[model samples]
Target chain A: MRQILSIATTTVGEAIRRRVLLIILLIGVLFLVVAPGLGVLSARSETVVLRGMMLGIIQLTSAVIAIVLTVYMIPNEIERRTIYTILSKPVQRWQFLIGKYLGAVFSLGLMMALMTAVLVFVFWLQASDQSLAAVGAMVKAPTMYFVQMSLLAAVAIFFSTFVAPLVNFFLTGGMYLLGSLFNPFFQTLQENQGTHPVTKAFAGIVNTILPNFANYNVQNPIINPTQVIQNESRYYLEVTFYGLFYIGILLVAGILIFDRREV
Target chain B: MAAAIETKQLTKSYKSRAAGNINVVDNLDLHVEEGEIFGFLGPNGAGKTTTIKMLLGIIYPTSGEGFVLGKEIGDMAVHRLISYLPERPYYYEHMTGLELLKFYGSLFGIYDEAKYRALLEKVNLHRDMTKTISQYSKGMQQRVGLAQSLLNDPKLLFLDEPTGGLDPIAHREIRDLILSFRDEGRTVFISSHELSEVELICDRVAIINKGIIERQGKLTELLHGGRIEITVGGVDEAFLKGLNIPDSNIRGLPVGVLMDMPEEQDPNGIIDAVRNRKGTVISVVPRRKRLEDLFVETVTNPALGGKPSVPPAVAEEIVK
Candidate 1:
C-alpha cells in the first residue's frame, strides 16, 4: 500500500506538469467561458442552450484529456527506464498499475473540477436570473462526468498494458464513441419488439462487453428544468458503483498482462 | 566466503519470425561471493542487461534456477535486501534530490529524514539535495541514483554502467563510492563496458560473449603472464633484433629501441649485449597483462575452459 501511494503521488506530480494536458484543459476552459454568447444562436431558450453547451464542452474535454493522459502512461515509464527502478524495488506489478491508474484519475478529477468551477461562474455570471438551486443542479453533470472520465482512463490503461500508445489511443477513443453514441441506439434496438433475434443477441453481447459510459450522462434533465427524475440520488449511486466495478475489472486484467510483460 | 549469488543453467530465449528461439542468455552459470565487487562485462546485445534483469526478478528465466542472498530468485523477501540501478536511469525530474530519496525510501516504509540526509552525504549530494533532477548534471544524477539504491541499506547492489559517459573526475568519484560499498560490507554487481573502470574497482569478473560465460575468476588469477620491457637509447631496432631474443618484440622508438618480451626471460643477457655495443641501457620496466588484453583474447577466441566453441559474429566484426 505504501508503495502504491508513493507511485501514485509521483505519477500525479508528473501528470499535472505535462504541458499537453494543460493546453487541452486551457482550451476546455476557453470554450466554457465563451459558451454563453454561442447559446444565443440556438433556437431553444438561451439559458437551456447555455447549460447544455457548457456541459457538452466539459464532457468532450474530459474524454480527450483522459485518453491523452493514459495512453502513454505505461510506455513512457518503460522508455524512460523509471519503471525498472521502481520494479527492481520490493513493489509489486499490480500495485504500480493501480497506483498509476489512481494517479490518472486524481489528475483528471483536478482538471474536471477546474472546468466545473468555470462552468458555475459562467452560468452565474451570464444566467443571473436563474436561481441558486438551478446552479446546484447544473453542477451535478460535471460531477458525473468525472466518473465517466475515470472509467475512460481505466479503459486506456487496460489497453496500454498490451498495445502501443498510438493503437491504444484509437482503441480507447473508439470504445468511448461506441459506448456513448451507439450503445443506446443498440439498447433500443434490442428491446423493441420488432427487432430481429440476431440483432438483439449482438446488442446483448456488445452491451455485456462495453461499459455504458452513457450511464453518467445526466445532462439532459439538468439542461431542461421541466424534466423530473424521481430516483435521482439512487441513479447517481448506481452509476458511480457501476463505473467503479468496471474500472476494477479493467485494472485487474491490465495488471495480469503487465506482470508477464518483460519491461 | 559464502556466495551472494549463484546460478545453474539459467537461460532466457526469445522467438522471432525469421529466427526461431534465439537465446539472449543461454545455459549459463555464475557465482558472486558475499561483499565483493563483481564485474559483468560484455559487448552490446551480449546479454549483460538481460542476465541482470533475470537475477533482479524484473523478468523470468526461460529455464534454469538462481539464488540471491541464499534465497530463490524472484523472492519478495530477497527484494527487500537487494537494489538495482540501471544504465542511464532517469529520476523523476520534478523531484528534488531529497524528494526522490523520500519517495524511494517510502517504498520500503522508511520515513527517516536522517537516513535520507546521511545517504545524500554519502554520495556527496548533500548540498544538491534540494535541487530537482533536471537541474543536476549527469554525474549528480548518477550520484543520486546511488543514494536511492542505498535507501534500504541493501545487502546487494546491482549497478549497470554506473560510471558510463562521465568525465574523469566523475568516474573517479563513482569508483571511490563503489569501492566504499565493499568496505561497508555490501555485495556490488556491476555490468559495464568501461574496462579500465572495471579493472580499477572489480575484485572478480565474468566476461560473457553471445550469452555464454567465456571467463570468470579473480582479477589477479585471470590477468597473468605479464611482459618485461628493456629500453636502450643508443641501440637501433635492427641491432636489437640481431640479438635474436626469442619471444620478444624489437621495435624502433623515436630516439631508442625497445625490446618487449615475456616476464620469465632474463634481462641481463640483453643488458650485456646493449652495454658491450655502447648502447646505453636507459630503463627496464615490467608490465603486467592488462584486463583489456585478457578481454580481447577471451572474447575474440572461442576457447573457454580448454573447450572450443563458435565465435560470435560481433567478434568477427571486431576483427574486421
Candidate 2:
C-alpha cells in the first residue's frame, strides 16, 4: 500500500505540473468566467442558461483533462524509462497500474474542483439574490461530474495499458461519447416493445458493457428550478456506487493485461 | 561463493514477418558468483538488455530457468535483494535529488531521511539534493540514479551501462562507486559496451553475440597470452637465429633485428644474446592482449559464427 501511495503521489505531482493539462484547465476556467456574458444571448431564463452553460463547460473541460491526463500515463512511463526503474523494484505491475489510475483521478479531481470553485463564485456573483441553499444545490452537479470524470479517467487508463496514446485517446473519447449521449438511447431501445430482437440484444449488450456515464449528469434537475429527483441523496449514492463499481472492473481488467505485458 | 545469478538454457523469442520465431536470447547459460563485478559485453543488437530484463523478471523468458539469490527468476522475494540501473536511465524531473531517493526508498518501505541523505552524499550529489532533476547535468542525473539504486541496500546490483555517455570525471566517479559496491561484498552484474571501463572494473566477463554466450570466464583467464617485442640494433638475423628462440618471430630491421616472442618466454635471454652479439638494445615492448582485441576476435570470428575467440597473437601465445 505504501509503494502504491508513493507512486500515486509522485504521479499526481507530475500530472498537475504537466503544461498541457494546466493549459486545458486554464481554458476551462476562462470559459466559465465568461459564461454569464454568453448566457445573455440565450432565449431561456438567464439563470437557467447560465447554469447550463457553466455545467457544460465544466463537464467538457473535465472530460478533456481526464482523457489527456490518462491516455499517456503508461506510455510516457515506458518512453522515459521510468517504468523500468519502478518495475525493477519490488513493486508489482498491478500496484503500478492502480497507482497511476488513482493519480490521474486525483489530478482530474483537483482540476475539476478549481473549475467548480470558479463556477460557484461566478454563479454566486451573478445571482446574489438567490439563497445560499440554492447556490449550494448548484455545486452538486460538478460534484457528480467529478465522479463521472473519474470513471472516464479509468476508461482511458484501461485502454492505455495496451494501446498507444493517440489510439487510446480516440478510443476513450469514443466510449465517453457513446456512454454519455447514446447509452440512454441504447437502454431505451433494449426495453422498447417494438424493437427488433437482434437490435434489442445488441443494445442490451452495449448498455451492459458501456458504463452509464449519463447517470451522473444530474444538471437537469439542478439547472431548472421546476425539475427535481424524487430522492436526491439516494440517486446520487446509487450513481456514485455504479461509477465506482465500473471503475473497479476496468482497473482489474487493465491489471490483468499489464501483468503479462513486456515494457 | 554461491552464484548470485545463474541461468540455464534461458531464451526469449519474438516473432517477425520476415522470419519465424527468433530467439533474442537463445539457449544462454551464464553464472556469476557472489561479491564480484561481472561485465556483460556485447554489440548493439547482441541481446544484452534482453538478458538483463529476463533476469530482472521485467520480461518472461521463452524457455529455461534462471535464479537470482538462489530463488527462481520472477520471484518477488528475490526482487527485495536486487536493484537495476538501466542504460541512460531517467528519473522524475520534478523531483529533487533527495525526494527521488525518498520515493524509491519508499518502495521498499524505507523512509529514513538520514539514509537518503547519506546515499546522495555517497554519490556526491548531497550538495545538489535540493535541485530538481531537470536542473541537473547528465552526470548529476546518473549520480542520482545511483543514489536511488542503493535505497534498498540490495545484495545484487544490475547496472546496464552505468557510465555510458558521461565525461571522464563522471565516468571515474561512477567506476569508483561500482568498485566500492564489490568491495562492500555486493554482487555487481553490469551490461556494458565500454570495454575499457569493463576491463578496469570487472573481475569476470562474458561476451555475447547474436543471442549467444560466446565466452565467459575470469578477465585474467580470458585476457591471457600477451606478446613480448624486443627491438635491438646492430644484430644480424643469422646471429638471432643462431640464438635459437622457439616459437619466436624475428624480423630484420634496417638497424638490427626485432624479436617478437610469447610473454611466457624470458626476454632477458634474448637481450643477453643480443648484447653478446654486440647488438644495442633499443626497446622491449610487452604488448598485453587487450579485452578489445579479444572482443573483436570473438565477435567477428567466422569460425565461431560471431562467437568469442582470442586474437591471432594470443592464440599463438597460447600455442607456444
Candidate 3:
C-alpha cells in the first residue's frame, strides 16, 4: 500500500502538469463560461439550454482527459525506462496498475472539478433558480460524470497494457461512443422479442461486454429539470456500484496481462 | 563465500516469423561470489541487458532457472534485498533530489529524512538535494541514481552501464563509489562495455557473445599470457630479423633493436640469440595482456560471426 500510494501521488503530480490535458480542460472551461450566449439561441428555456450545454462540455472534456491520460500511462513508463526502476523494487504489477489507475482518476477528478466550478458560477449567474437545492441538483450530474470517466480511464488503462498508445486511444474512444450512444439501442434490441434471434445474441454479447457508460448519464434529468427518476438515491447507489464492479474487473484483467508482459 | 547470483541453463527466446525462435540469452551458466564486483561484458545485442533483466526478474526466462541471494528469480523477498540502476536512468524531473530519494525510499517503507540526506551526501549531491531532477547534470543524475539504489541498503546491486557517457571526472567519481560498495561488503553486478573500467575495478568478469558465455573467471586468470619485449643496443634490426622467430615482430627503436615475441616463447633462447650477436641488452619489459585483446579475440573469431573490431589488414600489418 505504501508503494502504491507513492507511485499514485507521483503519477498525479505528473498528470496534472501535462499541458495537453490542461489545454483540453481550458477549452471546456471557456465553452462553459460562454454557454449563456449559446443558451439564448435555443428555442427551449434559457436555463435548460444553458444547463444541458455546460453538462455536455464537462462530460466530453472529462472523457477525453480520462482516455488521453491513461492510454500513455504504462507505455510512457516503459519507454522512459521508469518502470525498470520502480518494478525493480518490492512493488508488484497489480499494485503498479492500481496506483496508475487511481492516479488517472484523481487527475480527471481535479480537471472535472475545475470545469464544474465554472458551470455552477455560469448557471447561477444566468438562471433564475437561485436556491442552494438548485445548485446541488446541478452539481449531481458532473459528480456522476466523475465515476463515468473513472470507468473510461480503467478501460483505456487495460487496453494500454496490450496495445500502443495511438491504438488504445482510438479503441477506448470507440468503446466509450458505443457504450454511450449505442448501448441503450443494443440493450433494447436484446429485450424486444420482435427482434431477430441472431441479432439478439449479438446485441447481448456487446451489451454484456461493453460497460454501461450511459448509466452515469442517466442523471441528465438533473440538468433538464423536467424528468424525474424513481428512487433517485437508490438508482445513484446502484449505478456507482455498477461502475466500481466494472472497474475492478478491468484492473484485474489488466494486471494479469501486465504481469506476464516483458518490459 | 556464498554465491550472490547463480543461473543454470537460463534461456530467453523470442519467436520470429522469419527465423523461428531466436534465443536472446541461451543456455547460460553464470556465478558471482558475494561481496565482489562482477563485470558482465558483451557487444550490442549480445544479450547483456536481457541477461541482466532476467536476473533482476524484470523479464522472465523462457526456460531454465536463476537465483539471486539464495532466492528464486522474481521472488519479491529478494527484491527487498536488491536494487537495479539501469543505463541512462531517469527520475521524475518534477521531484527535487530529496523528493526523489523520498519517493524511492518510500517504496522500501523507509522514510527516514536523515538517511536520504546521508545518501545524497555520500554521492556528493547533498547540496543539490532541493534541486529538481530536470536541473541536475548528467553526472548528477547518475549520482542520484546511485543514491536511490542505496535506499534499501541492498545486499546486491545490479548496475547496467553505470558510467556510460560521462566525463573523466564523473567517471572517476562513480568508479570510486562503486569501489566503495565492494569495500562495504555489497556485491555489485555491472553490465558494461567499458573494459578498461572493468579491468580496474572488477574482481571477476564474464564475456558473452551470441548469448553464450564464451569466457568466465577471475580477471587475473583471464588476462594472463601477455607478450614480452626485449630491446637491445649495438645490434642491427637485421640481427633480430635473422632469428626468424615465429609470430614475433622485429622492429627498430631509436634506443635499440626491439624484438616483440609471444609469452609462450622462451625469452632465454631469444636473449642467447641476441648475445651470440654480441648485442647489448637495454631492457626486458613484460607487456601484460589487456582485456581489449581477449574481448576482440572472443567476439570477432570468424566463427562467432562478429565483425572484427580491428580490421584484418591492421592485424596482419602488426604481425608482419
Candidate 4:
C-alpha cells in the first residue's frame, strides 16, 4: 500500500506539472470566465443559457483533460525509464498501474475543481439573485462529472497497457463519445418491444459494454429549475456506484495485462 | 562466500513476424558471490540489460530459473534486500534530490529523513538535495540515482552502466562509491560497456556477445597473455624475423626493427641476439593485457565460446 501511494504521489506530481494539461486547464477557465457575455446572444433565458454554456465547457474540458492525461501515463513512464526504477523495487505491477490511475484521477479532479471554482465565481458575479444554495447546487454537476471523468481515465489506462498512446487516445475518446451520446439511444432501442430482434441484440451488446456517461450528465436539472431528477439522491448514488464498479473492473483487467507486459 | 545470485539456463526469447523466435538471452548461466563487484560486460544488444531485468524480476525468463539472495526470482522478500539502477535511469525531474530519495524510500515504507540525508552524503549529493533533477548535471543525476538505490540499504545492488557518459572526475567518484559497496559487504552487479571502469572495480566479470556468454573469470586471469615489445635500432627486419620467435610480429621502422612477442617467452634472448648482431637494443617494454583488450578479443572472436576460460590456477583458486 505504501508503494502504491508513493508511486501515486509521484504520478500526481508529474501530471500536475505537465504543461499541456495546464494549458488545456487555462483555456477551460478562460471560457468559463467569458461564458456570461456569450449567453446574451442566445434566445433562451440568460441564466439558462449561461448555466448550460458553463456546464458544457466544464464537461468538454474535463473529458479532453482526462483523455490527454491518462493515454500517455504508462507510455511516458516506459519511455523515460522511470517505470524500470520503480518496478525494480519491491513494488508490484498492479500497484504501479493503480497508482498511476489514481494519480490521473486526482490530477483531473484538481483541474476540474479549479474550473468549478471559476464557474461558481463567474455565476455568482453575474447572477441577479445570489444565494448560497444556488451556488451549492451549481457545484453538484461537476462532482458527478468528476466520477464520469474518473471512469474515462480508467478506460484510457486500461487501453494504455496494451496499446500505444496515440491509439489509446482515439480508443478512449471514442468510448467516451459512444457512451455519452449513444448510450440512451441504445438503452431505449433494447427496451422497445416492437424493435427488430437483431437491432435490439446489437443495442443490448453496446449498452452492456459501454459505460453510461449520460447518467452523470445531471446538468439539465441544475441548469433549468423546471426540470428535476426523480429521486435525486437515489439517482446520484446509483450512477456513482455504477461508475465505481465499472472503473474497478477496467482497472483489474489493466492490472492483469500489465502484470504480464514486458515494460 | 555464498552465492548472491545463481541462474540455470535462463533464457528470454521474443517472437517476431519477420524473424520468428529470436533469443535475446539464450541459455545464460551466471553466478555472482556475495560481497563482490561482479561486472556483467557485453557490447550493445548483448542482452546485459535483459539478463538483469530477469534477475531483478522486472521481466520473466522464457525458460529456466534464477535466484537472488537464495530466493527464487520475483520473490518480493528478495526485492526488499535488492535494488536496481538501470542504464541512463530517469527520475522525476519535478522532484528535488531529497524529495526523489524520499519517494523511493517510501516504496519500502521507509520515511527516515536521516537515512535519506546520509545516503545523499554517501553519494556526495547532500548539498544538491534541494535542487530539482532538471537543474542537475548528468553526473549529479547519476549520483542521486546512486543515493536512491541505497535507500533500502540493500544487500545486493544491480547497477547498469553506473558511470556511462560521465567525465573523468564523476567516473572516479562513482567508481570509488562502487568499491565502497564491496567494503561494506554489499554485492554490486554492474552491467556496463565501460571495460576500463569495470576493470578497475570488478572482482569478477562475464563478457557476453550475441546473447551468449563468451568469457567469464577474474579480471587478472582473463587479461593474461600480454605481449613484450622489443624495439631494436640498427637491426634489419629479416634479422629479427630470422630469430624465429613464436607468435611474434616483426615490423621494420625507419630507425628500428620492432619485434613484438609473447610476454611468457624471455625477451632477454632477443635482446642478447640483437646486441650480439651489432644491433642497438633501443627499448624493451612488457605490455600487460588490459580488460579492454580482453573484452574486444572475447567479443570479436566467436571461438572463445561461452564458458569460463580462466587459467587453471585461478580457476582452482576461485573454486576453493
Provide the RMSD of all predictions against the true structure, rounded to 1 decimal: 3.6, 3.6, 3.5, 5.5
What's the C-alpha lDDT at position B177 in model 3? Answer: 99
Instruction: Give the per-residue lDDT of model 2 (tens digit) for B1-320.
Output: 89999999999999999999998899999999999999998777789999999999999999999999999999998889999999998899999999998899999999899999999999998889999999999999988988888888999999998988899999999999999999899999999878889999999999887899989999998998999999899878788777777888989877767889888899998888778877799999999999988887787685775444445564434222
DockQ of 4: 0.72
Query: Residues A1-263, candidate 4, lDDT per residue (tens digit)?
Result: 88877888888899899999999999999999999999999998999999999999999999999999999999999999999888888888999999999889889989999999999999999987789999989999999999999999999999999999999999999999999999999999999999999999999999989999999999999889899999999999999999999999999999999999997
| TM-scores for the candidates | 0.92, 0.96, 0.93, 0.91
- Each prediction's whole-model lDDT (CA): 0.91, 0.91, 0.90, 0.91
DockQ of each: 0.74, 0.88, 0.84, 0.72
Prediction-by-prediction clash tally: 0, 2, 0, 1
A1-263 in candidate 3: lDDT tens per residue? 99889989999999998999889989999999988988889898777778888899999899989998999999999999999999999999899999998888888888999998999888888779788999888899999999999999999999999999999999999999999989999999999989999999999999999999999896568766678988999999999999999999999999999999999
Per model, kept true contacts as a fraction are: 0.88, 0.88, 0.86, 0.88
lDDT of 3 by residue, B1-320 (tens): 89999999999999999999999898999999999999998777789999989998889999999999999999999999999999999888999999999999999999899999999999999999999999999999999999999999999999999999899999999999999999999999999888889999999999887788888999999998888999999889887877778888988889988888888788888788778878788989899898877777777675644434334454333222
Show pairs that collide, candidate 2: B298-B308, B298-B309
Looking at model 1 chain A, which ten-residue stretch has the lowest summed lDDT?
Answer: A126-135
| Model 1 interface CAPRI class | medium
Residue B4 error for model 1, in Å? 1.2
Query: In model 1, where do residues sit more than 4 Å from their true spots?
Result: B230-261, B264-282, B303-320
Candidate 3 predicts chain B with a TM-score of 0.86
Off by over 4 Å in 4: B229-284, B305-320
